[model samples]
Target: MKQRSSPSAMTDFYSAAALVTGGGTGIGRATSLALVREGVRSITISYATSAAEAERTAKELDSLGATVLVVRADVRSTGDITAMFDLAANKFGRLDILINNAGTTRYVDLKDLDGLTDEIWDLTLDTNLRGLFKCCRAAALMLKKSGGAIVNVASIAGLRGVGSSIAYSVSKAGVIQLTRVLAVALAPEVRVNCVVPGMVLTNWIERGGGGISTEEEAFRVAAATPLERVALAEDVADVILGLVRSKLVTGEEIVIDGGKGLTY
Candidate 1:
């Protein structure tokens, strides 16, 4: 794969700052790196429990000559989320970008109603949906001050009904809707958009055992895709980079599944 050194379009991010939630790994990590490569001067990345991963990401970004702040935060806690925004604002002096990428889910059969316990539902909705809303709300002031942009990492599961779990699917669906609502509300000041990724080859899936339990299943899914492949974290991040750089684009949801979603 040809790596993108920076966003295709030029952006003033070289002098700006950003905050990326769940930036420890997966698409979040890729987005964080993309932002740094695109010349974002300072970034605050939040990780729930991935301290090792967060440290690794920080080191990588630091090596690239970007100011990085790694915070331990749980999206479910309003206080932690608020602190994340405050730290970014205080350290960076201004916040120009917010990436709502923190999310959680467990792999469960859709037919197993008993397996979809209240705890699982709460965990998924609180982190994936409600927590994202809180982050966006907390970021409003800083973003408005700099006329910044917000890019949410939703999933193709949100558009369809297939995902790791029913609650996860519902939560992501809420994220898609939330993106549109925030876009209209923050208009003329801050832009809000989302990227819906489909079946990305990330450790997140393996951790949750998201039905692709074997390499064979993954290969089958890839073969079924029109593009003969699934999405990569960097692929989704590139689309996000475009959204962040485009001053004229807002309230849009970009699908980055390499045409796999079309089959669904």
Candidate 2:
């Protein structure tokens, strides 16, 4: 990849190493590529079940001249999260950035409280909220040593209180609040921020997993949006890259919804 001019003098990507969870696909993949384009040479990407996709992404990063390490890690398990961080530390000796993008959700209407079973709530909370927290904790010492930055992936669902399921929305809301608290806790050593994306045209929605599963439904959402379009994963990734490079910004959430949230 062609390297771009460094955005901030405070952070040097050429000498830094980063860890991106869920780096196999979607926003995570985009963010990993953005880091490579910014001259970051070393990266460790963690995935849950997308082993094949993670390998593909690693190959692409290698082609871009980045030193890539792909690891299988399910964020829902503390042991997995710990092992992933340990391996990164051993391989890179330091960590300069962390992107907490691994998450899971189920499709159930918000009003159907009964459908939002205990299993759904547990899975969503454990994977999205709890898992993210564990990853942050695991990377804390290294990030503090490097004065690194963390950009978390939240959702417009947290802000608007509407999403695939009540549990999913609630879990994301926790992530937003957790970002703010961690910013204070990490202090001058590390910066924490979040990105809230609206309807992005990714496989998550295209495959009928997230709501608006079909192209026709997605088009309707885009037409209703103020910008008359949905977001691409790269769009959100750009904001994530900006946040990581920024020195003064912390505990902030940038929304990449094409202005759809304003109407609601």
Candidate 3:
């Protein structure tokens, strides 16, 4: 017997019901918008800053008549992440995709590890590494029950020893490891993969590496990439979509690095 479809489910028959963390701006924002364009009717964007930016994304997506929710969240907190899952699943009925995109970066001077203190390490790991694990743990359970996809936002630093800073690089490397483990553990029910970006012009750069440097210097380093340019958020978005929908692929890191790795 053919399964009967309801009016509500029918609206999203070809659409994904998804959750995107750190969706207020930059790569997360671009990915959320792209997901909408790809026919996801129900989307919840979680962020930690700039409620206005989140609202702007919601408003823009609303024009498509898609259901959009912008929630303030700290991925580092289990309570917040858990609540988001509950709310998203409750609203959408089921979650088909989870994009783990929330993270922070810093320039680490190993020689000053003493000065760095435990607070700095905890803060960085809490958000980038530990938070990602918690989210996947929560999302994996939800996705396992229904069979879905997870796209973890990592960095090229995970693949190579190079990145904006040692901490950022190491955190992202942990993300890739987490993705691999989850991919195997999730099995046939839920697929897990990663996307790694290189030299993207986002707020993190301005705040961490490029914050004190001149814009031209930033451009010079970015242009040193093989593609002679840095990645755009949208560039990362397209690759994410491909990974999310591809059932045959899991436990891989798609690099949106403008072929920067090839330059060597």
Quick one: best TM-score, which candidate?
Answer: 2
* TM-score preference between candidates 1 and 3, better one: 1
Per-residue C-alpha lDDT of model 1 across residues 1-264, encoded as one tens digit per residue: 984332322248897888899998999999999999989879899999899999999999999999999999999999998888888888878888999998888888889989999999999999999999999999888788788899999998998879888999999999999999999998778889999998888876667754456466568888988888877889999999999988888889998877877776
| Deviating ranges (above 4 Å) for candidate 3 | 1-13, 209-218
lDDT of each: 0.87, 0.90, 0.81
Task: Give per-residue lDDT, candidate 2, residue 84.
Answer: 97
TM-score of each: 0.93, 0.94, 0.89
lDDT of 2 by residue, 31-139 (tens): 9999999999999999999999999999999999999989999999999999999999999888999999999888887899889999999999999999999999999
With a 3 Å backbone cut-off (N, CA, C), the pairs that clash in candidate 1 are: none
* Model 1, runs deviating above 4 Å: 1-11, 210-214
lDDT measured at residue 5 in model 1 versus the true structure, 0 to 100: 32
Superior by lDDT: candidate 1 or candidate 2: 2
Worst 10 residues of 3 by lDDT: 4-13
Collision count of model 2: 0
Q: Which one is best on lDDT?
A: 2
Q: Which stretches of candidate 2 lie over 4 Å from their true place?
A: 1-10, 209-213
